[model samples]
Target: MGRTSKIVTGGLLVCALVAISIPVGKEVVPGLFPQDQSSTVTTPAAQLPPAALSQVASVSELSPDAPLPDAAALSDQLKEALKYDGAGTVSVYVSDVLTGEELFSADGWTARTPASNQKLLTAGAALATLGPQTRFTTRAVTGSQPNQIVLQAGGDVMLGRDDSKPNEIMGHAGIATLAKKTAESLAGAPGPYTLAIDDTMFTGSTLNPYWPTEDVAAGEIAPIYPMALFGARYVAGELTGPRPHDAPVEVAEAFAVALERAGVETIGIITRSKTPEGATELGSVQSATVDEQTQYMMQWSDNYVAEVLGRMVARKLGEPVTNEGAVYAVRKSVRNLGLPMDTIWTVDNSGLSVSNRVSPAQLVQYLNILLKNPASSAGQELKGLPIAGLTGSLSDRYIEPPSWEAAGVVRAKTGTLNLVTALSGYVVNSDGRLLSFAMIGNGLTDGPAPLRTVFDNAATVLAKS
Candidate 1:
């Protein structure tokens, strides 16, 4: 009887230990593990900030037959795979903009750094504030000294020799043409020539500390004082480069040299400065509409163009040109439209700043603002987007078999960076169902394929569901 008592006592102790583990299991892996490891693997519920436990609870509760009543049982399987797909946290949301019905929402409120996906938001903002028909300009003025000339800047991102992709060209005709014509105009006037470049149009604000300074100086972000006479980057083959800026400077200097080759002699120092107004518009050029600029900005994830345009918007709205001022302008303009921007944080005009954060729902909500406004001149440029596989950055996303969800039917923006990937856009299903979806993957490495697949799969499911 003593030995029996000892065995029973031992069993009771083991049971008590197991009881402590049950909560751990329920808290960590949810349904599968029977024993709890809260002490070892889970932070106590009280210690976790609201988001940690909330994401788990929201992702783990998919019961297959509820939200997606159409899928019945397969729903839970989908949720399970997404719960821990290597992305520390993944959020997905689907909304019928036409009916304003949110069909599925999983951790949609959590804001994450969206990488290039932030481009979409910038594009949206550009369209909402800057008119769709907007164009940037670059002009030339003759300096006080004969044969000397100044090329004015307008912070045009598309300024390049190549206007092949429409608004992709930031500013002007050709520096060569402008310079050459000036040479011809002064053929008999000045024995020696000198050309001065004035970039006074844009205030020399800090060129984003987040961007590589060397590359930016070389024009990686976008050349400040750009001069593209013939087509730029697109057709700009061969030639050596200091950077993007160096390339344009070389081009401008080459034009001066070419004028010498044509019998004109330049003795004046070629320098950079701003050209005053009332300055002659010697051979001016206009950029494409804002729609075209947005398309290209997304295609290559061009942060420079987006941010430059952002500053331009700030200037237009009477905001200061500094980073802080630019974002202040963005916030004011967005709020002016009646959209709630309390959760949106803009550290820089571009999403290059790590401090930038926004939610999937907010993106959709922003898009909805454009959709509902038909009256906004700036909001109508959504046409510049690549229609899935048709063109631009999304040219190869969302593989569909000759249906509405196919390449040409669904149009959207893709975002990504280290451990963070996001896609937000409007899609139409084969059955004429219109859907606006936002998928954000955080805790993944910086790249697009994995993020692409998640969105593609989600779109496929969204289309069918």
Candidate 2:
């Protein structure tokens, strides 16, 4: 039997492991054992303290000598677990993180609608192109005309209406703070200034024509904008409902109101114009870091954030910054990572477009890349994936029996549409091997709960292996 060794680092662990062929077993490994610890050592679960009993194993505890899951047996188990009772077809791909070996694959090469899973690709591209430390700046500057103030839209769409909160992802920068700063800058200089907005950071259609208008009206998504208050929501903390069609104007109006409270009177009408060359800077605030924003995008599956990130990617790559540009930029960036972009099709950064097609294999391969060098900029993508039965979209899932066994061990990104569902991310298996998997279901006639169960059960099987 061949032996392999690898060092896993970044976001999770910095450890080395040596693999050898051995029979798979059911014993759980302590994720944080000392390096000199014996791989065969075991502590009965019943003998452990309650706190230790409740703790799930972390990746650091994995031993390279740990037996890999029997591929053939694992395939049999997954095939059975993946069986769906409804109409749709499911494609699955699972691989070992250490050796990049395919453990199980079922129709993995065939592309299917990825739904929100498309955001994974967008997240990768944005992280790679714009970098994890990058931040978008919204600035208030003197307009080309007298008594004119221009509000320039950076790439932040999650602006708060009140003071900026330094520790938050949403509203890291606030409109009211910007207004106060702008008011101070104009002290003893002017009154009743004309307010205007500059949103040229993005160009072309604000709304993706490929997305259904009904979905837009229902607030599944709104027209993409450079800046928005509470992520275009009418109320902060509300994830869904009617959203402003023109977010830039809305943010500017809020700024106007804030400016009035800051002792700077603003004209009632908010106009649209570009900041003049060499305009005097009045005030500016930055969005959260790209890493933080990406985490938020993944955790909540925010369509607006994903789309804006896509546009930002386009701008970085010198693309047109339109829907077409964003899609092109994402595909190109992912391809640059050496993944087979030819195998998948994407229409939008957010998987809201039903036309988007991605194979389970492609998704798994991407996860593998992230796992290989967890410290790289691309590795930051892993941090954004939602932990099962805990944070993000997976919070309510994997909490029930049969699936609960995998909770806290599986981290994944989820996608859901009326006819499509997808779950892709990495998991640390019972044998202590890190594994990446992707499951996508399409053409579904059944309700999503059943299909989600099927997917979760499959992931749970991986965790147990």
Candidate 3:
């Protein structure tokens, strides 16, 4: 029979099995079978309980042998859902992950503002260049002069002011823990020591010139620093509000306070200086692995973490660890995946800049490349994407209505701006075929919420296909 016919037949067989497993007047406890009595119906050697039947159905639903969704039907459904009346235009692209076949396309090749969706490219480059297992290090060492100590930045902006929490991504490396170690190492050796900060790891402007000044004041992002507590936020665990413009200096002050608490006397004034060559190491702490940080970045759409990852990617490639270097590294890495670079324009690693331009087709194509090899570095980046209605920025989304059907089944990255909304990721359709898609709405005069819903609805269509 034809592929679609085979799928229909198999689906009918599964329904029959389920219908026969439960007899009349028997209460089925969801996944469990009726335990009161055995049915008189005789057929197969053994019948599966509801739970086992569910497992079988799930396995079959994801089976590689399952049929693909009909392209024409999927196209019509998506076209209807993508229609918007408010203001802006919407672009969408969907493709079969296994065969690289384009299933749906609507203005997919047109470049538009990507917003935070740019984080996906940054995440991919970081994993490909730095490896997921790599961890950034923050070090405390003896300075050139007597009674001098240097706090060296190592690209870990997620440091905690308190003791390290082994379980967390934000505070995996704690300043207090490092201070204790440093105090112990310097026991009986000094009185008051001058603390210096070496934040030269990242070169060039700390803040992106392309970002709006008001956005920075509103805590959309802060100056990029090599080392920071709570990703440069003024307070730990607080994701929004005003941020310190001099994050490195704030970190140094915190370190000085931590040193005093650990029984080491500090001179109070923190200086900016490079660590002396061959300086004696006092103590150090390592941040969470790049994989963990990337997951956190994707889940929360963290602009700070995204930029840091990009700079580190530049460092790995021996490129200048500046904003320009980070951008170049990200674009180069994505291009190396064999994607066309002519259509993609990125001024900053974090998609906070309206100048950033990326097409829906490009995102879907990139996702397909990652899906092809699950074990590759670029492939591992997919694991960090936010799950619909379940995690990160999407926790409150996909919780209602037709879009709710995609909850827990869709894994994607969300992007937002005053007039732009975007979603890009992958989902396994009801037919068991893996599909990658990207939806971007720009110039939305009706506002972002409505356009966001449109994107969500489009994803739901793919899930139920």
TM-score leader: 2
How well does model 1 score by local distance difference test?
0.54
Which tens-of-lDDT digit does each residue in 78-151 have in candidate 2? 98998877998889999987788889999988999999989988998999999989999999999998899999
lDDT, residue 410, model 3: 72
Task: Give the per-residue Cα lDDT of candidate 1 at 231.
Answer: 23
lDDT of 3 by residue, 1-465 (tens): 346434433443343345324322121111111112442132111122344443422211344665788999999999898878898888899998877888998999899999988898888888888998899999999998789999999999999999998899999999999999999999999588999999999999999999989888889999998988899997877878988888888888888889999999998588888999999999999999998898789889999999999999999998999999999988898888767788789999889999999999999888878777655776666667776665578766776777765665577899998888999998766555678999988898878999899889999898778
Sequence-dependent TM-score of model 2: 0.88
lDDT minimum window of 10 residues, candidate 1: 27-36
Question: Which of candidates 1 and 2 is the stronger one according to TM-score?
Answer: 2
TM-score per prediction, in order, is 0.72, 0.88, 0.87
Which ranges in model 2 have alpha carbons more than 4 Å from their true place? 1-62
Cα-based lDDT for every prediction: 0.54, 0.81, 0.80
Candidate 1 all-Cα RMSD = 18.2
Error of 1 at 399 (Å): 4.5
Candidate order, lDDT descending: 2, 3, 1
> lDDT tens digits, residues 1-465, model 1?
245434433333343223223322222111111112442243222212233333332112323222322433334534643444443677777676655567667888888776666665566667667776677766556666555666665555445432224323343334445455656665677567566666544455546556545544544444433334322343432222334434346555755675676576777567775565466655555666675666567655666667766777777877776566666777777776666889887676556555678888887776666555433644543444444444456544543332223333345666655456777776443233445778887767545465567566666555444
**Candidate 2 lDDT for residue 319:** 96
